[model samples]
Target: MFTRADLGKDERLDLMEFTLVLEHLGLSWTRAETQDRFEKADANLDGFISYAEYRAILEAQGWV
Candidate 1:
């Protein structure tokens, strides 16, 4: 049911939205905790969350 519109203005995945998706998927984590999670997810360290990175985060959160 997910769609491209879930992404942010920059067309990148926003951490807040990502967090919500994780919650909906029955996973839990704090915003502060996700900071490092995001950093690790941003494989290229480009400061923007890529689709691959987002998927990785979800997997790491046990969402998939």
Candidate 2:
């Protein structure tokens, strides 16, 4: 999931990549909802989601 979502291959997920992550998990959300989820997942508030952050969100949201 992380690998696929990291479209830039930069080892992190920006908002755009995060949206794709949601889609990969069979989730459809509005821009607001998607941004909200992405913000929540970015635990460190680094403006990007690292693999750890991604995993944390997956587990937290029961997507794992």
Candidate 3:
């Protein structure tokens, strides 16, 4: 149950945009890895992720 409220104090990005970024990295949205990343990105337990969240993960995981 992902929603915008999960962002907490983090910045915000559209859900589609977040999914797109992951897809571009060859990550399957239906896979556990994607789900894990989504949970991490959601931060405050909300269902959405901000661009900053994506950037943080990209940096941490060296995604690109």
Give the best candidate by lDDT.
2
Candidate 3: residue 31 Cα off by (Å): 2.5
Off by over 4 Å in 1: 1-10, 58-64
Choose the strongest candidate by TM-score.
2
The better-scoring model by lDDT among 2 and 3 is: 2
Candidate-wise lDDT, in order: 0.67, 0.88, 0.61
Quote each prediction's TM-score: 0.61, 0.89, 0.54
lDDT of 1 by residue, 1-64 (tens): 1344365556566667656655676657777877777678879888767677777766776768
What is the per-residue lDDT of model 3 for residues 1-64, given as tens digits with 9 covering 90 to 100?
1233334434554455566666666667666666667787777666767566666777788865
Q: Ten-residue segment with the worst summed lDDT in candidate 1? A: 1-10
lDDT of 2 by residue, 10-43 (tens): 9999999989878887889999999998898888
User: Which candidate, 1 or 2, would have the higher TM-score against the true structure?
Assistant: 2
Question: Could you give the candidate ranking by TM-score, starting with the highest?
Answer: 2, 1, 3
The RMSD of every model to the true structure, in order and in angstroms, is 2.9, 1.0, 6.7
TM-score result, candidate 1? 0.61
Worst 10 residues of 2 by lDDT: 55-64
Residue 6, candidate 3: Cα error in Å is 16
Q: Give the TM-score of candidate 3.
A: 0.54
